[model samples]
Target: MDTIIQPVARPSKRGSYRRHSDEFKRAVVAQSLLPDASVSRIARQHNLNANQVFAWRKLFGEGQQESGNNVCTLLPVTVVASVMAQPVAEQAPACGGIIELTVGKARLRLEGAVDTAVLHLVLQRLLP
Candidate 1:
């Protein structure tokens, strides 16, 4: 795919400022981000400086995170059975759990059903 890309904005003679379209930047950065891809090689193919491609990659990554596209929403999980305590001869099985976390002087203890999403948000704020 060596299609010709017309310059969005560049001095007719010679200069430092060369404005490129966001589409071009995104395309170049996407190519550069592929696994085991060489930034220098990709830049050379697009007739761009490696540093500029790297900068574009950084810009795109920041944009995605800001747009929540790069934000981690949650993890995949499956529930097979309820976690139950051992039952005795004349008693029914009890389902419960305990989770304890300490942050400096603050102590948190959760019993029974635990929402992983809530815990994840809490930890994201609590931990480094």
Candidate 2:
């Protein structure tokens, strides 16, 4: 008995390219910004790359900041005096007290009073 050989099939040459609408990208970016949301998980659910979502978020955030919509602004801070058993002069130290600052995901512990210029520089470096 003679056996017939079949020709092998070849893959398609055209590549698949998907285009997403700005509205869709905005919605996905918004979803990714939700508290406790996972970018990888969201991307997987939407059949998108995590990096793409991150890029969209960065672009959206920059636009908002440029428009002064999501710009970071300082609010009035109130400091209250704590009552102590010892006299104020005796209890007070030569240097100022410690200050804890939470900037983004960074936690900074600074002992004594920080200089205005130094603090400004530190914050500028710490922030994006």
Tens digits of per-residue lDDT, candidate 2, 41-91, equal 999999999999999989877235233345675634445456456653465
Candidate 2 backbone overlaps, count: 0
- TM-score result, candidate 1: 0.38
The C-alpha lDDT values of all candidates are 0.72, 0.74
The CA root-mean-square deviation of candidate 1, after full C-alpha superposition on the true structure, stands at 16.1
TM-score of each: 0.38, 0.40
- Give the per-residue Cα lDDT of candidate 1 at 103: 59
Stretches > 4 Å off in candidate 1:
1-13, 62-128
Q: Which pairs clash in the backbone of model 2?
A: none
Clashing pairs in 1: none
